[model samples]
Target: MHQTETSDDQNSRQAAKPPLRIIISRGSDASSFTVRPLMAALAAGTCMLVIGGYLAAAGYMMLREDNSDTSRLTQAAQTRFYEERIAKLRARVDEVTSRSLVAEQRYEKQIAALKKRQGEINARHSRVADVLARAAESGLTIAASDPLPVAKPRPALAFDATLAESTEATGGAMVPIDASVDMLGLRGSMGGVAKKADRRTPASPEKATISSEPTGASAGLRADSVIMSRIDSALDVMNRQSETALDLIAVAAERRIARIERVTSSLGLNLNVDGDGVGGPFVPLTSVSFDARLARAEKAVAKLSSLRDGVKSLPFGSPLEGAHDYSSTYGPRLDPFLRSPAMHTGLDFRAPIGTPVHATAAGTVVSAGRKGGYGLMVEIDHGDGVSTRFGHLSRIVATVGDRVDIGEVVGLVGNTGRSTGAHLHYETRLPSGTVDPELFLNAGEKLSGIL
Candidate 1:
């Protein structure tokens, strides 16, 4: 027993000590559990770690929501900036397109044609422009934007229908037209641009913006491929419209001139279209082919001038100022005095006594006195072999050789000539002899509004 007392025995006694015991109590029951100090501390530390983790997660979620709002606001501002930039670019493109609109008349074409016919196009455009200028000078001002001048063209059909559709397709906000472009001046610059266009190869839309243009062109008026294509199309439409207008005007003028010629022939008169006074320096025609359209236009212009010069000289005025009612017509009629078939050489106008007679046209008084049958008469010789005679006058105021103008008072009405009562005998004497006075008066009525 004395030999069992060793150091190892004491260390094993400390290590074998039991854990603490605790008792749990409730209303009618109770329980007991044992726990070590290290285990209690470890359980408390686990609960704290879970609570701290949950709080950290909540703060992170709130921060994320705030960041999302800031992100949305930043994105919206950038979108608006881009939208404004896009609008400005569109405005600039439209403005560039308006440059060609300054030219008058109209035409249209496809983008495919842009690659071909550069030199020919330049010359053709000049001629097309002249069509408008000439038409305007002839009193048919063809507006650049106007459709075909024909009344039926407003509805559109076939070619016109295509133009109408294209017009609608190209419609956009148009710039106001105030200034005019000098087309002749633009030729050189346009040719250079055309060369540049030809030298370049086709590229994608994104890279097809104009690189450079002639300095003589409108300042800073450049465009992308889309805008350039549209401009080309508009110019073509204008040219076509001009040609259509020229055709209509030329045809109409020619027909009117033809009718005028027939009327003059019936009167036994010649109308010299190229007047007596015309002299100018002769310049040869341009290198461009003499356009048949231009030739037609020139002819039309000549005819218009003829109407102004020749027709104005014709006796297209009334002999009686306000009253031209005829009691007896020219040609064979029953004689009012003899009651026999007689050849009437003049028109007898119904009028009261002492009515003032006016000269039918501008002329010199050749005879202004009484004759055998015509008691108190007057005869005036209008130029170009045209003469007028007024008989059966009460009193004659114009003497022989008196230069008289149209509508000037020459005499008074009365029963002076081979007396049938108070009336006027008017005769229009042509080279073949006295023709119908009514014919000239009727023609005058027809042309009163026009010439």
Candidate 2:
């Protein structure tokens, strides 16, 4: 067994140990070298491949992670910014809406006030129309020629007046009158605006120009001032018109007073003054004046009275109307008993024997007795030397010294004085002598005395 194993083992071992190092030697100045280029090249190439693979993997991983994080951060920032913007927008929108609502409310209030003013203006127009209608009926014409331009309307205004009313008493009743006035003005600027707009020209793009006016704010301000001024002028004119109307009313009242005074005078309800150029039918001629010499005394008596207030001290109404028929006249005439010319000096009225005899003025009775020719005669003495004589009376109702007013019953007509027929004989006399009586017997005027 030892002999067979020794050759195989010795050959295998020799083959495995065959490779060895080679060296080259030269002269003493030469060098010895060993070379393995292929082995060195393979080792270097292997190391470079390993490093390149590692670097490519690391760069790919870093790029992918960075892209993902950048996308997430961008999305978060966009959401936050959008939320803040939305909140700001909502606040601005709410503020604008509130302002709009307030402006609308103010506009509505102004419109309502304007409407109320218009209604008042319409009412005033109606009143003026009524006044004009009345004036037309009374043959009057109203002419308003001057036309002032309208500016703007003014706020409402008011005033007061005074008037008089007639009551049951003779005096007039004065009363306070309340009135109101409205004002407005005329203007022409708004009407001119239409003309200005019509004259505007079209814009041109080639022109390098900016519009001088930015907005209508200035125009609106100008219009307001003009309107206010116009309104003020109109108010002044309206005030003047009101004053003039009041003056006209005063003049009309004066005319009415004059007419009333004339009526009272015709009715003989006034007192009289003699020789002072003032008298009423209530005063007898003898009492009023005596040859026009006692004017000062008459004036002094008139000063003591207030006849201007329409008060009278005597009843001066007419006793008879046109029914009175004169059977005889005043002044000298033929006496019926004597059948020849004689002084009659009296007026006569023919009537039945029982016909009433009326007193002509306010007076006191002085006598009721038979006279020379006037049987059953009555004499009355009015104040201031004025006396009345009644003859041809059958019976007397008033006693001596009894006061009687005009139109009062004095006696009954009869044929008692030198009788020719049933009649009444009335006469007036002064302290000096007899005077004509028929002048004061007018039915339209007051009688001078009572008989």
Which candidate leads in TM-score?
A: 1
- As a TM-score, model 1 comes out at 0.46
The top-ranked prediction according to lDDT is 1
- lDDT by residue for model 1 over 38-156, one digit each (tens)? 78788788888888888888888889988998998899999999999999998887775674553211223433455454445557667756665654544444443444323211121
Model 2, residue 72: displacement in angstroms? 35
Looking at model 2, the pairs that clash are: 149-186, 150-185, 150-186, 150-187, 151-185, 151-186, 151-187, 360-449, 361-449, 361-450
Alpha-carbon deviation at 217 in model 2, angstroms: 21
- RMSD (Å) of each candidate, 1 decimal: 29.7, 29.1
lDDT of 2 by residue, 1-451 (tens): 9987999899888777634345566666555444355556676788888888788778878887898789878877887788888888888888867765765575466456555654654554454445444433332223354233243233232211121110000100111223221221211211211100010111111111111033464565466556655655664455344333323332332233334344445543334322145455664332432223123322332332233222222223233322444545553333344333345466555455666777766788898877766777888777656677778788988889898876678888766746555666777766675655544443113211111
Q: Residue 117 CA error for candidate 1 (Å)?
A: 13
Q: How close is every model to the real structure, measured as TM-score?
A: 0.46, 0.34
Q: Stretches of candidate 2 above 4 Å error?
A: 1-322, 443-451
Q: Candidate 2: deviation at residue 427, Å?
A: 0.6
